[model samples]
Structures are given as structure tokens and as C-alpha cells.
Target: MTGIFQANRALLFFLTLAVLIALSSVVVVDENEQVVIERLGQPVRVINRFNPTGASGAGVVLKLPFIEQAVHLGRGLKGYSAGAQKVRSADGQDLLVDTDVTYRIIDPVRLVARLGSTAKLDAELASALPAMLGARLGPLSAAAIALPGNGGAAQLLRGDLDARARDLGVQVIDLRIGRVMPGETALQMTYEIMQARHLREVDAISAEQIASARQTRAQVAAQAAAILQDSAGKDPEFYDFFRAMRSYTYVFENPDAKNPPTIVIPPNSSYLRHFNGQ
Candidate 1:
């Protein structure tokens, strides 16, 4: 029994030693990340330097567990929202705009030196992008900022970003006006005013057309009446005959049958007197 107890104690001691050895080192690099192995907080090895496609040099990357450290650098595109901001237009219109910035760790060394970590980069975006967009876009009128025309607003903003983004170590490939609308409580009022203006224009055009048509109709009718009057005055006999024909048509086609229709005679009674041969 004494020999068995001694053997068990020895086995327990070796198992504890093995567990300690395993805990002394760790590797958390994924296939999409580049691992920087550091000793005493200083970079010693950079694995997967060129490409992030495969798990190259991705084994039990040994390190003194508590003394050594490893940082996995992200190797692809990442994005963050800059949140909504009230940007003013050249015409003093308040526009709430949001921006999304897409950037990548191009130079890991520079990124580590400048930003220290990916979390730091994200934290910096909130403050950085708003200042950039606001400084670039503010003091423009709503029409200019929102680009009331075809695509002028976006072109203007792109030019601004292109000129300035290089200093930030990130390329601003594109920025867009996501949503632009009136940001006041009187939005409905503004809409109604715009509608009223359009409706007034339409009504003015309609009224002008109506007046023009009326003038044309009146002139044509008056001209036709004058022509008929002149022709009738020149030819009295035919005029009298046509007058009698018109009177006959009016009397015969009158719809009311309540009383017998009578053709009132003039003082000379020229139509019937001429027909009677005196």
C-alpha cells in the first residue's frame, strides 16, 4: 500500500506540470487574421505576412503564458456608421444625414503605431467622420447639399472626400446622401405651400387658355355675324325669304304643343304680301 501511494503522488505531480505547460502559451489567430507574436510586450514575430487566405504558420504558437502576448490583426475591409448628423445646406436647410465609412488595415505596422487596436479605430470613427462630413457639407443650402439637380450634390461631396481623405490614411471611395427631407415640424406646411404654388401655376395657365378661347370664339362669332349682316343688307329680297324660312323652322320645330304656333307678321308683311301678288 505504501508503494502504491507514492506512485499515485508522482503521477499527480506530472499531470499538474503538464497542465501548467499547456497554459503557458496560446494562439487565437484565425485564417483571416495576421498574428503578431510579442514577447515582454514587444513584437517578435509577424505570421502570415503577405496573404490572409490560408492558416499559414498557424500552429501552437508558443509563448510564456503570462509574460508573452499575441494580437490578431484584422486583414479585411471593415465599416462603421458615423451616426446621423444635422448638416446644413447652403440655403440654410437642416438635413439629418448619416455616413458609413469603409476602411481596411492596409499597413498593420502603421495601424498599430497610430491606432493601437481595431477597437480604437472604431471608437475614433464616431468623432472623425462627423467632423469631416459636417465641415465639408455644412453652410450649403438644402438644394445644394441634397442635390436637387440630377447628381451634382454627390459629385461635390465626392470631390471633397477625395481631396481630404488621404490625410486620414483611408480612402473615401464613395459617400451618399441616404435620406434628405425637411426636418422641421412644418413639413406638411411646406409641402402644402409647394403644392399651392404648383396648383396656382396650373390654374393660371388654365385661366389664360380659357380667356384666349373665349376671345377667339367671340371674335369669330362677331365676324361671322357682321358678314351675314352685310350680305343681308345688300340683298333684301333673299334676306326676306331666308327670314321667313327661319321663322317657319322655329315655329314648326317648337316642342311645346300646348298652343298652336303663330308666325307674327311685321307691319309691311312683305313675305306673305309678295306671295299673294297684291
Candidate 2:
């Protein structure tokens, strides 16, 4: 009877231990989500990653208990709202815009290496989307964008944004844009317009500085010409030697040395009189 009781206790202990191990090691990857298994902070493998070829890595996956971590990423398309953004048009018009981006993690390993998690990805797009809008829509006609149906703004943004999204390990599937006015976006646009005016003032100042620089260069060149004339008046032979030295300097110190002059001078040419001690 004592031996039987001991055997039953040992069996129960083994069963409980197995259940605990199973619980720790089991990972469930949903149809809409992908799981990245990491061992000691390094990604080991991705499960249920996006596969258009129909080899979706969904279903139950196992990882080393206590040694590996599982990170969840959406296998399907995920939508990101960039909120209201203010843009400066080519005609110096400030526009308030709202946009939504549809994206999916194309490379899980790269996404993990760069952004770590989807939350980080969201934070990145939140910051980057506005800047992208400024660059893309700024050069386009503001009047057109303000017209009906937002002037196909989504198509324009999606095309370029998708190309840029490749670096972020994401594929931009779609983009939706609308002209937003009279709210937080309007206030932001007001601030941007004021900043633009300030930038124009600064540009005016820069133009004045550039004109002053050109005048200074012209004055210096005139002074140099006077010096050369004075040297010519001193001695005719000395002037010739001096001129030849300057010519030599110009020839040897050519700015376009990569394509240096190819003309060949004869040994007894008049150009070599100074070198010949004449």
C-alpha cells in the first residue's frame, strides 16, 4: 500500500510538471497576427508572417520556455491615422489635411530590428506622415487639392509613401486623404503661415547679403587689375616675365585639372622665352 501511494504521487508530479512546461512553451498565432519568437532579446523566427503564396504561418507555435519571447505583429493590413497635418503649398498657401494609411509588416525581422514593436511603428508614422505630406502636397496646386473629392490626394500620397515605406519594412496598401479645416488643424496652419512669413523675411535678408558679397568681389577684382597695370608700367622686360609667371600659374593651377589642356608647345616657342633666360 505504501509503494502504491508513492507511485501515484510521482505520476501526479510528472503530469503537473508537463502541464507547466506546455503552458510556458505554447504560443498561439492568430490568423490576423504574426508572432516573432525571440531568444534572449534576439529574434529566432517569425510565425504566421505575411505570405501571398498561401504559406501563412498561422496556428500554434512553440518556443523555448523562459528563454524565448514572442512579439505580435499584424499579418493582415493595418490602418494608421496620422491625424490632422498642416502643409505649405507651392503658392505659399497653408493647408490643413487629414490622412489615413493602410500598411502591413512586410519583413518582420527588419521591423523588429528597426522599430521593435507596432507601437513604435505607430509613433514613427505619426511623426513621419506629416512631414511626408508637407513634402508631397507642398509642391502641388493647393486649389486643386481644396476642390471636390480632395483631388485624388490619396492616390498621390499612396504612390510615393509606399516607395518610402519600404525602408521601414512595411508595404503601404492604401491611403485616404481629405481637406480638413476650422479646428486644431486650422490653428496649426495659422502658425505655419506665420512661420512662412518669417522665413520670407529671412530670405530677403539673405538676398541683400548675397548682393553685398558680389559688390565686394567686384571691388577686389578692380584693385587686382590696377596692381597688374602698375607692374606692367615698371619695366617692359620685367612686366613680360611677371606676366609669363602669372600665365604659368594659371596653366598649372587650372581648376578643371581633371580635363587639363592638351596643347603641346614647341621647345623654341616664344612662350618659353622667359624659361630660356631670354
Candidate 3:
């Protein structure tokens, strides 16, 4: 009975030791993660979602128990918005600029060597990006930066930033200027200038329309005069009679006038002869 008890105790001890070793030696990496194995604080290898064979490294990975340490990092695109920063425009105008960047770690080994950790990387970017933007944008006018789309300063900064970020093992997918707000004084001045320009345009359009209307009125009056002259040439007596009748109607149609106008006229007057049957 004592020998059987000793054998069972030894088996339990060995089983416990084996389980501890297995747990320490195994590393599990997810599909969206990259792991860096370091031996004695020195980087040994990088196991990521994509290997040289194009296979995912998403299962139990073997490492030396108690010797190798694994550091996991997310393998996904990261976005950083560097909120409003004060910058000077080329025209010597002070403005606030907001910016954003999208990037991904292309080489984890290089990233670990240079930046050490994601927090450190973020700090570096926060310091570096605004300085870069200010330097590049400082030579441009407020109007240029405030215009829509990627401005000239932003484009230049994007190229320069991408080049600089390459050293940190990151690929800058996009860099953009989100907003540009001018100072209060500049904003008021710009508004006034725009208003003045719009007023000038409106005045010009009104002047053109008035000139066109005057020309059309002159043309219509000339046409009416020519038609009247043609009718007079065809029959002078009838035209004279029609003229006398029109004058009589104008002088008599006034609501305040009596049956005949108060003005006196000779009985043989050509205007009054229209009322005579002959």
C-alpha cells in the first residue's frame, strides 16, 4: 500500500509541472493582432496575421518557456485627429487649423525598435504633426488654406509627413486639413469684402438690365411712330379726322368735365367739327 501511494504522488507532481510548462510555452495570437517575441529583452521574431507563406498566424505559437516574451499589437488602421491648432498664414494672418491623419504600422519590428510602444508613438505624432503643419502652412495665405478640398499647404505637408513617418515604420494613408478658421478681425473683414464685391456685381447687373430696357423702349416707340406715319401717308384727310376725334375724346372724357369742356373754342374749330354730322 505505501509503494502504490508513492507512485500516485509522483504522477500528480509531474502532471502539474507539465501543465505549467505547457501554459508558459504556448502563445495565442488573434487574427487582428501581431505578436513580437523577445528573448532576453531583444527582439527575436514577429508573428502577424500575414506570414511569408500568406497564411494567418492565428493559432498556438511555441516559445521558449520563461525565456521569451510576446508583445501583441493591433494590426489595424489608426486615425488621429489633431484638433484645432493656432497657425500663421503667409499673409501674416493668425488662424486655427484642424487636421487628421490615417496610418497603419507597416513593419512591426521597426515600429518596436523606434517607437517602443503605441503610447510613445502617439506622443511623438502629437508633437511632430502640428509642428510640420505650422511650418508648411505658415507660408500660405488664409484664403488659400480656407478654400475647400485639400489645400496646397496640406498637400505639401502630406508628402513631407509621409516621408518622415516611414522612418517610424508607419505608412501614412491619408493626411488632410479638416478646418481653417480665421481670427475674429479677419473674419469680419472677409465678410465685408465679400459683401462689397456682391454689391458691385449686383449693381453692374442692374445697370445692364436698365440699359437693355431703355433700348427696347426706344425701339418700340420708333416702330409705333413709323406705323402711324405710314397710315397718315395713305390717307391724309382720314388721318386728320382721326386725330381731331382723339383730341375731342381726351378733352371730354374727364369725369369732372361737364357735357362739353369748360374751355371755350370757336364753333368752326376742326376738333369740334368732328361732332358736326358732315
What is the C-alpha lDDT profile of model 3 across 1-278, one tens digit per residue? Answer: 88998879989899999999999999999887888898988889988743445477677899999999888877778888887788888889988788888888777877878877676776777778868877888877878888875366777787877888889887788888988888777789999999999999999999999999999999999998897799899988778887887776787788675566677879887667767854
Say which candidate scores most in TM-score: 3
lDDT of predicted model 3 = 0.82
lDDT of 1 by residue, 25-69 (tens): 767556567666667766677765435353365455667777767
Give candidate 1 regions above 4 Å deviation. 1-7, 26-28, 50-60, 113-116, 148-177, 184-278
User: How accurate locally, in lDDT, is each candidate?
Assistant: 0.66, 0.81, 0.82
Question: Candidate 2: where are CA atoms >4 Å away?
Answer: 1-17, 148-153, 182-278
Going through the candidates in order, what is the number of backbone clashes in each?
6, 1, 0
Scored against the true structure, residue 159 in model 3 reaches a CA lDDT of: 80
1 or 2, which is superior by TM-score?
2
Lowest summed lDDT over 10 consecutive residues: which window, candidate 3? 48-57
TM for every model, in the order presented, reads 0.53, 0.57, 0.59
TM-score ranking from best candidate downward: 3, 2, 1
